[model samples]
Target: MSQITRIKGSHRAASLVIAGSAVTTSGLVATAEDAVDIRAQTRSVLSQAEALFSRAGLRKSDITRVQIWLADMADFPAMNEIYDAWVDPEHAPVRACVGAALANKHYLIEIQVYGYQPD
Candidate 1:
């Protein structure tokens, strides 16, 4: 049987963990309740991803792949700039970036990662 785990945060949705893989659902923007910037939002998502991996007892080098969805294609370059520095250059994971209208218009990007936690 596959074990499932979830983590809820203010800006991001529940991150689901099945076996060794972590799947982050789309994180929607907060309306009147909270205020955050575009770059901050992107950083939050990355932070959430990192936390998920940590909770699973894995390291950044364990990540095998990642999928990034952006509300606007124009944000791709900016997102990539941060992502490149965020990951280890020697063991970067395979990734795909796509343009899509996210849950809320305020949200600029959402990233989901797949990692391996060796037994």
Candidate 2:
């Protein structure tokens, strides 16, 4: 079995997983200590995901798949607005966004990313 490595964020969860050159993370929510509105929370989640990518020696362009969970479908536009700004449109990966209950009510968005590093 490939050893799984966890890339921990400033938050308590050690969610990011690494095996071989592949990297994947669990749903990451807003990093703001205080409760934030949907727009702000969405941005925060993306920022945190970016940080994780950096830690894993991966770039947004390396992402192969992206999964997003929103507390409300209405937040789609808001989440994509920030996400579109963060990801490279020319090399965009497969993605899915759906409305679902999150770990925290304060969280408006959560994202998981998977990427592979060239050997």
Candidate 3:
């Protein structure tokens, strides 16, 4: 078994972690100007996720699954507008999105990603 390694730049415990060929991240949320705006927030979250994937030497296409949490279900359409554009149709990850209260009231959406690389 391989020792787990950590990815910096996220909150404690929920930061990105990698062991062997797989990469896992704590739920990603928006910050600064992005948090309150549904579109910006969704974009910020994906950008954060992309940065994590890059840190793991992977790409958005590498992600196999994702779970999205939305603070308001009414924001779903707006969030999807950004998400549908960000993900590649051919390699789109299996995904789930649900409305829920988030850790931060300002956060409109949160995302967690799972990705893999073949040895």
Best by lDDT: 3
Residue-level lDDT tens digits of model 1 in 1-119? 56676555434445545553544333333233332655665667777677667776777888888888888888777777777779899989998888898877777777778777666
Put the candidates in TM-score order, highest first: 3, 2, 1
Model 2 lDDT tens row, 9-86: 547667688888888888777766624677788777777777788887778888899998888999788777877887
* Cand. 3 TM to true fold: 0.92
- Which pairs clash in the backbone of model 2? none
Write down the worst ten-residue block by lDDT for model 1. 26-35
Predicted structure 1: lDDT = 0.68
**Model 3 lDDT tens row, 3-25:** 78887754457478888788888
**Model 1 TM:** 0.75
Quote each prediction's TM-score: 0.75, 0.86, 0.92
Residue 103 miss distance in model 1 (angstroms): 1.0
Looking at model 2, report the run of 10 residues with the lowest lDDT sum: 30-39
Q: lDDT, candidate 1, residue 6?
A: 57
Q: Once model 1 is optimally superposed onto the true structure by TM-score, how far is the C-alpha of residue 71 displaced, in angstroms? A: 0.5
Model 3 stretches with alpha carbons more than 4 Å out: none
Estimate every model's Cα lDDT from 0 to 1. Answer: 0.68, 0.80, 0.87
Give me the candidate number with maximum TM-score: 3
Task: Give stretches of model 1 more than 4 Å off.
Answer: 1-14, 20-37
The RMSD of every model to the true structure, in order and in angstroms, is: 3.8, 2.3, 1.4
lDDT of 1 at 117: 62
